[model samples]
Target chain A: MRVLGVDPGLTRLGLGVVDSGSPTRPQLVAVGVVRTPADESVDVRLGRIAEAFDQWIDEHRPDVVAIERVFARSDVSTIIGTAQASGLTMGLAARRGLPVAMHTPSEVKAAITGSGRADKRQMTHMVTRILRLDAPPKPADAADALGLAITHLWRGAVAGASTPGKEKDVLARRARTTAGTGLTPAQQQWARAMRAARA
Target chain B: MRVLGVDPGLTRLGLGVVDSGSPTRPQLVAVGVVRTPADESVDVRLGRIAEAFDQWIDEHRPDVVAIERVFARSDVSTIIGTAQASGLTMGLAARRGLPVAMHTPSEVKAAITGSGRADKRQMTHMVTRILRLDAPPKPADAADALGLAITHLWRGAVAGASTPGKEKDVLARRARTTAGTGLTPAQQQWARAMRAARA
Candidate 1:
């Protein structure tokens, strides 16, 4: 299954695509960041983001799209921008009849690093190891997007038979319950890598 | 000049159109509300809004779009939805090379009535008189949208030579400064009708 993960923002949006043959092995297909000028009007910025989504979706043709959900508690100024951007992405995906899923930051971190409070550095390291990339993706947002995509694949694949909306609830519930569970088999591999680096 | 005003909301979006021959005289062209099911997914709701915007803009061929600016302090659950809907409306207008303006709720109220603190009943009464309609527009949202369009035409025409973005700021500043001042010439006509009603 192929998935496109989006880290929605007004000024800097991160997009990552991954193809998963097995739940444990996901390969990176593409990764990039779309940046809009901070000085531009909100509508213009949103227009640019919409154009970028159109270009990416047309080129990548992912089976499903996964986006990081915006929480109201996060930076009030940015929350609205992020929500608008996500709305555009999801709308475009829905227009194409592709299923879209939303993952919280904590769920993405826990899915990737075995801890819900994993920091950016830890997420980058795990994403790198998961995709077997020689180097971590540039711009923390890009790596974070990859983590979102991987999380959806790992969790959604398990509940793939359910409807998209129901799958989201199931994944969210699982994320809450599995918060501190030592890592998935794929994350366990990364844990071994961390131990090896320490040695 | 032709203007389309949008009162952005997720479940019930309000839209109105008007043609301004003179700054003091504007004629209503169309008005309605677009309702989306509350149970629908965010993306689906956004798509419906986009479709509605397309239809309105295409039919009315508005020279510009005036949308209600969203404030973060509003109901937390609805704020993001309104923002997203407004973003879609603005994005669509921008795509068509049509200018878009945002008016605050207080600006709309003050423009329609002589006071920014005017209640909905006052707004509906003023809108009914201004539009020369047999009855007030159904669903307060629709009346509110017509008020938005009228506000833009009256205020924007005064600063019509300026750029769209700059005109919005200019109108907002003017609205702030002119609040509770004697009514505009068009508003004076409404005042007479109001006085006649009281008598």
Candidate 2:
């Protein structure tokens, strides 16, 4: 199935598309970013985002939409904006009847670079190699959205290869490096809501 | 000088404008949000963001633009996207000869709520009281952008309040919180950076 990964930001929203026709690997189809003006108001900025996202949805029509979920711990403003951004992505996917999945920052790193603490440069460098791109994706944020797509594609393929009796839970693909490591209790509650939305 | 504060995100970019004539309290002249569709391609998203931002700038000539700075220590994709988002805001501000200032999540919290660990509800509540608004700003994220503007005004006021023989370093605020403890070298380095950013 075709997949679209998104790195959401109000000022710059990144998009990457991967055509997963083959079970083992997906081909990069397109990647780009959306920008919002620093001068506009919150409502106007949100409107701009909606319009840009709609155009992409109409063009790609992907089966699955992957979004980078923000596990916000502090900064009420940051978390609220991130949550709104995530909400916008999910709302659009739901409107189109497409399946949506979210990957945490840690899960994304482990999938792309084989470690959760991999830096941005490392993730981009690895993405370029794995996808065999001509150059690293520009505005690294867009590249990251693409990376999320790649991670989901690869994990999905790995799942396809596993035996039915021995398949692992999709979320368990990464190992936590720190003790007491897990989504915060509140975030876990959000995860349940997201899962239900996907179902 | 007129200042614009932006709370960036994918689907909604919140923008708030305040002309802090006295730097102690800014007058709120404008506020709004920009929205985007989920399906747009990367390029289209960028276009919309630029177009929207440009339109807003043309309408309101802000002398300075303050944005919530992205933390680079987190996930690479997020860091990259945040960096890109910061670039867009900075670039837009530059186009209009407006100096740009970036504040971290913690600084904004401490400036507004008197605590860096304050949650969204608390910040919103505080911003409302500070702005003397009839109600909390809608969509929560928008309220935050406004709060950032309020913070800049208050911070500037404090800076302006010093006389020839007087000074008000952020150390006083720090001492309020760190009254009994000594910080490590690394923490001291961070404190300097945080102060320089005026966050």
Question: Which candidate number maximizes DockQ?
Answer: 1
* RMSD values, in order shown: 6.4, 15.2
TM-score of chain A of 1: 0.80
Tens-digit per-residue lDDT, A28-103, candidate 1: 9999999999998888877778878889999999998999987767788787788778777776777778888889
> All candidates' lDDT scores?
0.79, 0.65
Fnat for model 2 comes to 0.00
Q: What is the lDDT of residue B46 in candidate 2?
A: 39
Please report how far candidate 1 places residue A34 from its true position, in Å: 1.4
Candidate 2, residue A20: Cα displacement in angstroms equals 1.7
| Residue-level lDDT tens digits of model 2 in A1-199 | 7889988766788899988654334578888988877687544555566667768889998878888876545354455445445555555565556777778878888877778999988888877766667888776678789889977776665444343533233233321223243433333443443333223
TM-score of chain B of each: 0.80, 0.74
Residue range B86-134, candidate 1, lDDT tens digits: 7777766776778888899999887788789999899899888877788
